[model samples]
Target: MLCQDSAFRLYLDRCRRHKFGLTEAQLPDGTHNEQDARDWICAACSIESRAELDHNLEAWQTFRAIRNRFNRWRARGGA
Candidate 1:
């Protein structure tokens, strides 16, 4: 239920905004929704589902790496 977690969802949104340099409202295609973040997470973690992050060590590690990078990006004032 990681994707369902409010804080995590917010984190995803923030990360996306930072990476894309655009807010959800500013996106030309009208995408950048929660599902898009979920899909991005799944693809980055190499998992078919977000739930696998809870049980799959490799996916969890990959997710941690992504989070760490996001944290650094935030620390550096990205976006």
Candidate 2:
């Protein structure tokens, strides 16, 4: 699943740190953990869960768009 992918998880961490400007101390529990990333992904994609990306075409497309944007940012050395 997308949520279980190591690379994607790392990207999420970077996104929170760089793109979102969120530090661990700034998070609710002083941690930018897996659940936080999953929550962010769900919120960003307007889906209830990461599993939805597998069966929901719209959610998958939205996730892809997000990933593409993140990749572009990374390519430009934004992370």
- Compose the digit string of candidate 1's lDDT tens values, residues 1-79: 4455455555666666668798667643324456766888899899998889889999999999977776676577653
> For residues 1-79, what per-residue lDDT tens digits would candidate 2 score against the true structure?
5555555566676656666677755642324456766887899889997889889998889889988876776687654
Clashes per candidate (backbone, < 3 Å):
0, 0
Model 2: number of backbone collisions: 0
TM-score to true structure, per model: 0.60, 0.59
lDDT of each: 0.70, 0.71
The residue ranges of model 1 lying beyond 4 angstroms of the native Cα positions read 1-31
